[model samples]
Target: RQIRSRFIDEVDSGVVRTETGATITQKADRFSLDESSSPKKSTSATSIEYDWETPVSGKTYKSASGSTIEYDLQDGDDPFQVGVIVEHAKFGPGKIISRTGLGMDAKVVVFFKSRGQKKLMLKAAPLQVIG
Candidate 1:
């Protein structure tokens, strides 16, 4: 006596096998296939929002009547210029004492009242008018 083996492909069910004159069927799992299709990923959107207003020069920095912003602080060693007023969403209101960059791409070394002197990049566009 001789035994034969064969494999069969099932479209809806899965696969079928034949060994030693015996037939066996396998069922397909829907969840196992779908689990890999869905992926967990982080959203690429800005969560913080900022408001703009006129600055009162020597007045105390506050959220109201001024611009509010936030920074990722993810790029380079630092960003910001010293001796120049800058808008740091993370450090709030401050001035830049030095700058670092070549031509069009320069960052500021700002001295914030809250965070002291630190480096932060300057985002283009004016948020408020400071006297």
Candidate 2:
């Protein structure tokens, strides 16, 4: 109160500002922020979705974010049996230990070098024979 009357009121007579006990008001009807305003979020991966291409080995697809996401597709040739070595698109190298079912329902247990061991479907599991 004392500072406003002594300091502010002395130098505040140009635009004519009114000060009341409850309020000190100034008119700003000419204020505009349209030129400085913009969207909070810019064009991003989530806002502008990426249409991924069909994943295949030796082929690469770039995302909207500019990074190439590696899509390990499930593709392989069946030469599966016990003691057969194979390379998976995702799990790296593994050896076939056992199998179950046949053809489309075929599933095999494989011991992976990095992922320990897991069972994979023959028709769906992405594998390539290395050995």
Among these predictions, the greatest TM-score belongs to: 2
User: What 10-residue stretch in candidate 1 is worst by lDDT?
Assistant: 35-44
Top candidate on lDDT is 2
Candidate 2 overall lDDT versus native: 0.58
Question: What's the lDDT of the predicted structure labeled candidate 1?
Answer: 0.41
lDDT of 2 by residue, 13-94 (tens): 3344222112233333322123232233222325652232332344454534454534344455336767899998889999
**lDDT scores in order:** 0.41, 0.58
Question: Each prediction's Cα RMSD?
Answer: 21.7, 22.7
For every model shown, the clashing-pair count is 18, 0
Q: Give the TM-scores of the predictions, in the order they appear.
A: 0.30, 0.40
| Runs with alpha carbons beyond 4 Å of true place in candidate 1 | 1-82, 123-131
Error of 2 at 6 (Å): 90
Displacement of residue 23 (Cα, Å) in model 2 is 88
lDDT of 1 by residue, 5-72 (tens): 23223343223212222223343432112222113221123533222222222222223335543443
